[model samples]
Target: MTSNGTSIPVTADGIPRPGGAGSLAGRTVSRIGYGAMQLERLRTDRAAAVALVRRAVELGVDHFDTAQFYGDGFVNEVLREALAATRDAVVVTKVGATPDPGGPLPLRLAQRPEELRASVEDNLRSLGTDRLAVVNLRRADTGPGLRAEGDQVVGLDDQLAVLTALRDQGSIGAIGLSSVTADGLRRALPAGIVCVQNSYSLVSRDDEDLLRLCTDEGIAWVPYFPLGGAFPGMPKVSDEPAVHAAAREIGGTPAQVGLAWLLHHAPNVLLIPGTADAGHLADNLAAGGLAPDGEGLAALDAVPSRSADDVRLG
Candidate 1:
């Protein structure tokens, strides 16, 4: 059964339809990858978390997005245990943020070269890997955190220097950027940006231009909050009337329709929708197989756009 409580359909060969594949930093990965953010918030036991990761791999999901800041390394620990033997998995993690020890829910930006190096070491230690598949430098000045007066942030070059050094040292495979603007991308591209992870969905198209830029440059656009974050007052893609109507028409769930729209929206898009529930994972992966018609695409495109601040995370 899927997240919407529908029976999963298989092809005539009895094989479950796999998610489509896309290239990220020269590596081919399933467009429908798993995100580890939800694992940080899951109240379930460790076994359950590990099981979910294994299940995702079993379902042919190769790309997994995670960060050391998530659950103060709890999520990466879970991934370490789960993916220990899964050599084919592509783990993408980020730097530039750490949980503030004094606060219950505040993150401190650690963008300095020294801090970034330490964070990278922590991620490697926690995930039990020598080299990460991709390391996205989370721009603290942009997105939902502190706003920068200028397009460029201080110490960005130094941070990229650290990442480039790591890549040269074989500690990481590819470099990326997160929560960055088009100008930010322009600055970081010279340092070798292979992907851009930003907030984007049917209701949040603030990164539309950046997405195009990524496409033009052959960089993968990995969208966070692809279904819109579940924070209060934030728009939910599944709740959109157009999504619901399209779901009905296609015999799928609203979430499935939203994800389908994203895949259809761009070839460079690589989805990493996070979910702790097995059922939801199945639904998200199945969405990659959906081919939305022109009508469905039109409806999805017509959804109102929300402010970038509304969907960005600190």
Candidate 2:
């Protein structure tokens, strides 16, 4: 569905903006999509979450990323109620681990082939859809306590087998991977993988190499936490005086500047910045319209990379 009463534009370079990308299960999604993890907080503020999601659609966000583990089923319910009537929208979800009582803190792999099948059923029920647009095999680092039986986590071959089986059955339109490393992506890319959901942003450039690899391979790299995942990070160009001065001069939030930097950085990058607050959502969507010049872009690129030890992957 076209948002803000503006038709989805086909850029001069011919790439479409929001809702211009090719179909994912007959749903034309915007490359710059919305990640729906914030919907999990709906239990505390249902109206706000629903409004933010609907408003995101109104702001040209036609693609939404969610997962069965988001709210133990709540987020999907919100998406179902909010966007069910929309004609052209893509809803993506994942399967791999079941959330323990604590939260996404510890993921217990429920991806044995049978369990994977069961999770697909649960996703379908929660999402209120017959076929999922894209289903990712979600992976996360095993905590200290959960690492003993590491084999419990589904291996690449096993996960691929399950996905291929489901694909043959027409349960999902496309397959993707979430939280995978460079090695993992290399292994999966040959299997017709269409997308890779990794934690990437201006402050956290840990995925830079992976991002380049995906761009070279013609795969979509959907980045989560463009400004900051939970806690905010420092400026993009740590030592660049000009970028810092410009950030202050614009009177705009540092976040708006950071997001604008990402949009200008790469063509294959698709950002899914999640927020429960309507104001923050509006600010994020507005970042798409900002055009930072060569000096600004160079200043951001000049930012020094963080030490390997300092980069933390969730």
Among the numbered candidates, top lDDT falls to 1
lDDT by residue (tens digit), candidate 2, 80-131? 8888766567788888777676633534666676777788888999988888
> Model 2, residue 158: displacement in angstroms?
1.1
Best by TM-score: 1
lDDT tens readout by residue for model 1, 137-235: 988544444332332345678889999999999999999998888988898888889999887888888888899999999999998878875555556
Error of 2 at 267 (Å): 0.7
Which residue runs does candidate 2 get wrong by more than 4 Å? Answer: 1-28, 103-111, 141-149, 229-244, 249-251, 307-314
CA shift at 297, candidate 1, in angstroms?
Answer: 1.1
Residue 163 displacement in candidate 1 (angstroms) = 1.0
Segments in model 1 whose C-alpha atoms lie over 4 Å from true places:
1-17, 42-44, 101-106, 145-153, 310-314
Worst 10 residues of 2 by lDDT: 141-150
* Candidate 1 residue pairs in backbone clash: none
How well does candidate 1 score on lDDT at residue 131? 95
What is candidate 2's local distance difference test score?
A: 0.68
Reference-based TM-score, model 1: 0.89
